[model samples]
Target: MDRTGKSDSGSSSMTTMGMVFVKAQNTPLYSKAWTPSTTGGYASTCIFLLILAITSRMLLAYRTRLERSWHDKAINRRYIMISGQTEADRERQAVGKGGEKTEVAVLTANGTDERVKVVRSAGRNLEGKPWRFSTDLPRAALFTVDSGVKYLLMLAVMTMNVGYFFSVLAGLFVGELAIGRYTGAGEGHH
Candidate 1:
């Protein structure tokens, strides 16, 4: 305005156009400008993705709990006397119904089967055994899925929108607060 000594409307309009483009830069993925039509749907999508990422993390915590529980049950066991011998015998000979010595196989938490001296008690059965830890194949598949989801959520957050990124973080924080206690993170804390 000072250089030309005249009021200019063109410059003001150009400034407004720049502001519009700057706002549009934050549009959600696979979306157009943040119009009324797209706003609700995009917001819902972001919230869902964030919740899914948080749920996956929580599930990972649950899996770890299961692993720890299994370890405690298997290795930290009480002394059991089988066939008139203690666990110090390493392997106990058990006579089958047919009077033949049989080896008892137990599935360890690590998905590998181990031979253990087992007593046939009323509380024990093959189908009633404790839940086994996730096998390598299933664990790998879960990791892949979780990683893919997290990365996608990160990318959505990288779009630099206040709504999407904050939603993701809120979900994570809320999930931690909700399930952290059951996953051992609440222990030994004041």
Candidate 2:
């Protein structure tokens, strides 16, 4: 007890009740509290976060690379090919009977099967000529970075890990706030 010739105050400093006191200093509450369970839990959390973060990063990178490669290929191709919208255009063009030129065919998004009816110069204004020819695409969706859509999707999909981190932080913050609020509420009751 030394200096006081009685006892140390720090050991009894946690709280006071007139002459009585409750000590919390040097408590075992958290001191050297390492344990197998705690270690395992920490390891598991680390592994999970690492896996999720890395996978999210890699998947986004791979998809972005793939998309870029596709756009590059499309750019290299000089021919304009419509897809998904071509067939419909062809059908609409052919509606003018056995003769006549069909106009305004639906452009398909797919380039492989662009069909344009050849109109013959007879019943229709024109004949034996394709109602529509898929025109050269000035640019593709993936190539133009300014499309605004792919970029947003890429941003969101690429940063899933960040979102998860935010979620964790939000949970922790909320928990602390709630605890603080409850503690304050109890104090007010006195």
On lDDT, the leading prediction is 1
lDDT values, one for every candidate: 0.55, 0.38
> Candidate 1: which stretches are off by over 4 Å?
1-26, 30-37, 73-134, 184-190
Per-residue CA lDDT of model 2 for 1-190, tens digit only, reads 5554445654642432343222322211112452124544544443444444334333334445554454444334332333354555667645645543444334456643334333333322322323222222322432343334333333323333343244334433443444433332233110
- Distance from true position, residue 107, model 2, in Å? 24
RMSD of 2: 22.0
Q: What TM-score would candidate 2 get against the native?
A: 0.24
Model 1, 1-190: lDDT tens per residue?
5454444653442222222212332365635553324656666766775787578567667666755665545443332333444544534345433232344545467763443454443222223345545544555666677677667767766666666667777877777777766666643121
Q: Worst ten-residue run, lDDT, model 2?
A: 22-31
